[model samples]
Target: MRPREASALDALPALPRDDDGPVFAEPWQASAFAMTLALSERGVFSWAEWVDTFSGELKRAAEAGTPDDGSRYYHHWLAALERLIAEKGLADPAILVDARDAWDRAAKATPHGKPIGLSPDDLARIRDAG
Candidate 1:
């Protein structure tokens, strides 16, 4: 791993890590983890900012009676990322919402076990909405 990535993981004590690296239960979890580190390295937010947002997400999920299973951990991470991005004015919240809807549509349309690629119309719709 790159030094920056190593430092990022080192800073994230709550995250599960081993000699191999941070362990992720699923592909999307890994994507979310990488996105947060990349954004922090770009100076979009501090690692502390991520931790603060993520902690709040975890707390809220717990209060809402969500199970504390490892399965839903990354779901909370993604929520925190979205919240932080919007709160920091890094991206328009509406754009995120539109992109999410577009991706959901694309995923549902794609076949099981096949890669989901967004169609031109999906891109156009998000762009138009923005």
Candidate 2:
């Protein structure tokens, strides 16, 4: 994935939650969703094309007896993203690997304990500085 895509995915948990719950209840789903949006926004594919591809993938998965649970759905999304990236020559696999590693490190460094030490904005600035 591109760095912006990864960052977008990483930001999902911090976004205000929708009534259905969090917009992304799972990490992989967030990643997949961000990737789809990023690719579409970048003009690599149209939104209609993305919907069609997702529908096709869902149908194939159903035929294989795997219903469209979130994880499987995201897996399909990731596969589609990978295919598009490859077809468009957007970035090589090595770049994606590096991006993933950077994202993972950032995710890990995020505070998980009780809020302390600073206001949210201040903490964010501190993290950004680091």
Q: Model 1, 1-130: lDDT tens per residue?
A: 5565456667743744446545886788999999999999999999998999999999999999997766688999999998998898877877887788888988999999999888898788777865
**Location of the lowest summed lDDT over 10 successive residues in candidate 1:** 12-21
**Model 2 C-alpha lDDT versus the unseen true structure:** 0.68
Candidate 1 global lDDT: 0.86
Q: Where does model 2 exceed 4 Å of error?
A: 1-19, 69-71, 93-130
Per-model tally of clashing residue pairs: 0, 0
Best by lDDT: 1
The lDDT values for all models are 0.86, 0.68
Each candidate structure's TM-score, on Cα atoms with residue i matched to residue i, is: 0.68, 0.50
Where model 1 places Cα greater than 4 Å from the true spot, the runs are: 1-22, 111-114, 124-130
Model 2 lDDT-worst window of ten: 114-123
Candidate 2: deviation at residue 44, Å? Answer: 1.7
